[model samples]
Target: MAGIQDGMTVMVGGFLGTGTPEILIDALVEKGVKHLTVIANDGGLPASVTGTTDRGVAKLLSAGMIDHIIASHVGMNPIIGKGMNDGTLKCTLVPQGSLAEKIRAAGAGLGGVLTPTGVGTIIADGKETLTIEGKEYLLELPLHADYALCRASICDKFGNFSCYKATKNFNHVMAMAADTVILGAEKVVEIGEVDVDTFTTAGVYVNYIVGGEQPWQI
Candidate 1:
């Protein structure tokens, strides 16, 4: 978390509350940085929605740490609307599939992606569009970040990571899209303890590791 500073662009791995690195996120809150541009699927569940504590990115949102967001949706958290209406926050909403492809394009080292998702909608406004074979496509550029926060169900000392079911949502691809990847795991083991085939993401993409994350309350 030391490498992340004010005004940095951060990609947070999650879909709602799932697959989010809560421990690492809390550490960022404790780090007290500001003016961050966060890229994610959703804004996460607010305490009001969870009926418990704030979950996932809601922690940062409530602390007013993020100044801007590039996400698919933010309806889960009411704060997003309030902040935007007051001019304290800036938000850019991308289609879910397009957002995923943009992140994937970055990881794949591609210039951009051609998608027809927003052709007749406002999402295509001010964006470059091209017609090939009578179909229109928008040019969505790769989305990179200064740092990425990812969650894992288990990880070895060398960072071979694993997560089950919905937990793999953004964590896998996000690891490859950032300059540095910080992993927060529910369990950590030594090398060879877990079979190599069980690993979903290779260890090579991870930069730092933190362990003992509890299951998300949400």
Candidate 2:
């Protein structure tokens, strides 16, 4: 929380709107954090379609708080298209599977990942390529963030977390790939309340935890 400065790169954990940490994002918007570079799966759904004022990264995008984004898709959010066309925001789109592997490589402390997902396409334009056994693979660099904001279905006092259903999509990986990890949990329980067997993210990776709001509120 203390080190969130201007132009910081942030990784937000979510698939569409399901797993985004809405509470932390709201706080960031309230603080007027600007010129951010966000990394996520998709741009986010619009308020009109979701029947809400803001959801996922759209909150920051709508507030003009973000300057650039590296995501796999943006078609669902008109704001992204408008910004890109108007030159207000910059976007770099990646193959979805490659995106996930890049984040995972960062978290795992690997130099990079090799995949065929982007071979022979524009995605490989400026990237390195390697041939192994007569097959080609594009080298995608790891994607790390200065901070990561994630949502958890449940979090304990010590910050151990478990997500419900599809909410776990990227939260667990993003938690390990950032310098600072913050979580917003729907339910905050005592340290021992969350079973270790069920925990997807350990407290050692988390820096802070905040109470989360319901889906409607987000």
Candidate 3:
């Protein structure tokens, strides 16, 4: 089976609240994969920020494994800056909402999506510009990855997934666009344990399942 490897691009699912997938991140670490390009919302906790065991992508960053980062904000953690300055990390910052839409467009097989988020700013520098009616829009290419790391509230043996409350962030869209998808879950049950009405992510997108991390460990 295709597993983690060096020099691969990975899409990670998480947002401030319900989106973090601690288990999947840990699994990647355990796999000892390196030279990665990670696309995510933010850097996970850092040793300087929380002072406990490292959680989220922080563990990967601390390991000096990642080669590039495509994220909305890396400044939330101090170690990220040091890594960037010291040439251990390379990054490209995209707006949060725009980042989500880009992943969705990629998953849906679209070439790109049009948006006005970064117009008239540094983000518009080298991108194509379009005028629809009287408003201007910037075309952002869709983002897909070699692998997508996601987390869910519960999943069945068949791979269908659902997120709880606010944590549902990018997990849903990233699942669709990646070449391979792996999920971290709080609970796993029979295929029918979760009702069809609440099913947000179907089984076809997921490939593996790992348990979740301790409560708010990251």
Clash count list over all predictions? 0, 0, 1
- Model 2 agreement with the true structure over 1-218: per-residue lDDT tens digits: 56788999999999888899888888898888889999999877778768866688988899998999999999999999999999999999999899888999999999999998989999999899999999999999999999999999888889889899888888998998999999989988987765677677888999998985565453
- lDDT of each residue in 20-71, candidate 3, tens digit only: 7777777678778889998888887676667676767787888877899888
Q: Rate the local accuracy (lDDT) of all candidates.
A: 0.92, 0.89, 0.82
Better of 1 and 2 by lDDT: 1
Sort the candidates on lDDT, descending order: 1, 2, 3
Candidate 2 local Cα displacement, residue 144, angstroms: 0.7
Tell me how far the alpha carbon of residue 135 in candidate 2 is from the true structure, in angstroms, after superposition: 1.2
Instruction: Please give each candidate's TM-score.
Output: 0.97, 0.96, 0.93
Name the best candidate (by lDDT): 1
CA RMSD of all predictions: 1.0, 1.4, 1.8
What ranking emerges by TM-score with the best candidate at the front? 1, 2, 3
- Model 1, residue 5: distance off in Å is 0.3
**Which regions of candidate 2 deviate over 4 angstroms?**
none
Clash-forming residue pairs, model 3: 18-167
Clashing residue pairs found in predicted model 2: none
Residue-level lDDT of model 1, residues 1-218, one tens digit each, is 99999999999998888889999999999999999999999998899988998888889999999999999999999999999999999999999999999998999899999999999899999899989999899999999999999999999999999987888888887898999999999999999997888798999999999997899653
